[model samples]
Target: MRRFLDKLYLVSGALAAIFTVGVLVAVTMSIVTRQLGVHIGGLNAYAGYSMAAAGFLALAHTFKSGEHIRVTLILSSLPAKGRMRLDLCALVIACIIAGNLCWFSFKLVLDSYAYNDISTSDDATPLWIPQISMAVGTLIFFIAILDETIRRYKGIPETIQSEEAHYE
Candidate 1:
């Protein structure tokens, strides 16, 4: 089961990396095109969309790796047991908050799809596309947080270790 979850995280991270590359490629092409005195009508819109997707897709993996910003000044001052307790508390709160975010984001995506929402840009890209990716990222982040919470509850050491592991 841990392997399966690890695989899922890897897949999601790969998707995000691919999407990030897509955005970078699109931007590079856009720059070249503009240099050649060409105005690509949809390149800007597409790059924006790709960036949004990449950010959303990477969120879950980022959270899992403790790559999210956190206030550690106070938490870091605690003893080992106290820090562990705080970490557990933080994970539980994150599970609750990220869970709600995931639920609401999923519903938002569905609502956008139902409305057939589209960008007002000339590209008229479907808004649901990015929203869907963002929702998936949020959902995955919640699941990862739940796993972390379980690990913390189960007294899994190193579940939240390293100062650099605290945030991305």
Candidate 2:
């Protein structure tokens, strides 16, 4: 299960990187086409979509990597038991928030699909197509948070411990 979860996060991170490259590609094409006196209808919209995908998809991996910002000063100041309790509390709250976001994101995707919603841009892209990434990303992030919560509850060391070690 650990291996699978790790792979999941790695894959999510890779997809996020791909989407980031997608944003670059879309924007570059938009600029180049304009320079060539050609107007591409949906480049801006594509770039926006890719940016959203990249941001959403990167969440789980970033959290797992300990790259997300933290108030380490407070956490590091605490004794081990106190720190664990605080971390567990934070993880529980995060789990709830991420779960809510995941549910709502999927709901939004379903609603869009049901309504046959389309993008406002010239691309007329189906909204659900892009929304899937948000839904999936949020789902993965929720899973990651829940996993960590369980691990912490079981008295396992925090995933960020290794990263925190560098500062000591």
Candidate 3:
């Protein structure tokens, strides 16, 4: 499970980087094209799509890396039992929300695939590509949340401990 989650993190991070680069390149090219008075493409729309991909796809990996923000003020002052209990409750809620997101995204991917959907832009990029990224990332994020919930239940003292146990 740890291995799978790690792979998901790596994949999502890679995809996010790709999207970020795409956004940069697209914007620059669009600027150059407009300045030179040439018909290049829809720069704004393409960048929007790439940004969406990067932002949504990086969510799960970010959560897995403990990069997600939390109101740790109260959590930090609580006793161990209370903290763990609150963590468990938060995880449960996250799982439910992420699970729903995955379900809806899966259906979206299916619908797009069924209709052979394409964006109504000059590029006409296939819609499934983005949907798949969103769906998979959300699913992996939920899995990471579930993993953390289990670890909290098991009293994980630090991320280093989880890393060591993950390999051993």
* TM-score winner, 1 or 3: 1
For each of the candidates, give the backbone clash count: 4, 0, 0
Considering TM-score, where higher is better, how would the candidates rank from best to worst? 2, 1, 3
TM-score of 2: 0.96
What is the TM-score of each predicted model, taking all chains together? 0.88, 0.96, 0.85
Model 2: ten consecutive residues of lowest lDDT: 158-167
Worst 10 residues of 3 by lDDT: 157-166
Highest lDDT model number: 2
Q: Per-residue lDDT of 1-168 in model 1, one digit per residue for the tens?
A: 998987788788899999999999989999999999988778888888888788877877877676778788877899989998998898899899999999999999889899999988778877888788889988888888898889878988754456655345
lDDT of 2: 0.94
lDDT accuracy of residue 82 in candidate 3: 92
Clashing pairs in 3: none
Clashing residue pairs for model 2? none
Q: What are the per-residue Cα lDDT tens digits for candidate 3 across 1-168?
A: 778778878898889989999999899999899889998656777898888889888887777766676777787789988987887898889889888988898899999999999988887778887678777777777777777778877887435323334458
In model 2, which runs have C-alpha deviations exceeding 4 angstroms?
162-164
